[model samples]
Target: MSEKKPSLLEGFKAFLMRGNVIDLAVAVVIGAAFTNIVNAVVKGVINPLVGAFGTKNLDSYSSCLKAPCEVGPDGEMQGIQIMWGSVLGATLQFLITAAVVYFLMVLPMARYLARREAQRKAKEGVQETLEVTELEVLKEIRDALVAQRAGGNAGPEGSPAPGDRG
Candidate 1:
């Protein structure tokens, strides 16, 4: 008996041809490109504007220890050098990225989805209205059939005509 091995090319083709896989690939590429653009904007425009406010590029906003800790005979400092400025800069970057992504991408996406949902509901409303109208007509027909079967004039017994119903 001979065993057949699956072709790698066939598997690759199938993976690439899947709908969700293709969408994910496209999203990843677009996300990478968007990240570069956001980084450039942060580095170029926002950083400079922040620097004008004396923040100094968001990376130099920390204070260093004035008195250096004692060093060993080998000349290495016993105390650690705190790089809090880098952490501040990273936090600022994260905030800016979050704000931009929310305002530029997420907010608009939510608005667009809401509008699309509203339009879908509007369309469904029309269908529902038609269904309700048909139901009302059927109810009227059923009432008439019941009245006819009872051998009455489809009105309350001993009731006057429409003009005299008051």
Candidate 2:
């Protein structure tokens, strides 16, 4: 008998039904929306500030050859145009994103988790100390029981019986 292949719909349904897959899909959508905001911030605020430092636009800072460079048919210089400015802009955006995520999300989350851990540790410490104290008390009780048993078996003047002497 030939094996039946799973349909695309079934595969898609399984994918969507997975917990992590659905979460990832939601995260991707949110990330895309957040990217737009970050892009606007970079283009509007950061670019102007960088431009004031003589870099004009983020797309214009590149190494270009002067005279003796090969000329195209349109009389334009034909040299290796390294678009380093775009790279710089992308790098800046990444830095900004990292900074924002760190300060806004990661830092607070870390602090909250730390506080929770500390509280848990404090609770555990108290529990462990209580257990230790209880054990100590139990040991004292056991020692008392053993002492009582020994006392009951001993002779009147704290001497052993003839048969107890070893």
Instruction: Return the clash pairs for model 2, or none.
Output: none
Q: Give all TM-scores, in the order shown.
A: 0.66, 0.72
Error of 1 at 58 (Å): 3.1
lDDT of each prediction vs. the true structure? 0.78, 0.87
The superposed Cα distance between candidate 2 and the true structure at residue 41, in angstroms, equals 1.5
Give the clashing residue pairs of candidate 1, or none. Answer: none
| Per-residue lDDT value at 152 in model 2 | 72
RMSD of 2: 5.9
Those runs of model 2 whose alpha carbons end farther than 4 Å from true positions after fitting are 1-11, 66-78, 152-166
Candidate 1 ranges beyond 4 A from true positions: 1-5, 53-55, 65-79, 149-166
Estimate, for each residue in 1-166, the C-alpha lDDT of model 1 and write its tens digit.
8898779998899888889998998999998898787778877877788788886567766554644655669988655556676786667677877898899999999999999999999999999999999999999999987766567433467665344445
Over 1-166, each residue of candidate 2 has an lDDT whose tens digit, in order, gives 9999999999999988989998899999988998998999999999999999886589888765444446699988687666789999999999999898899999999999999999999999999999999999999999986776676767668876545774
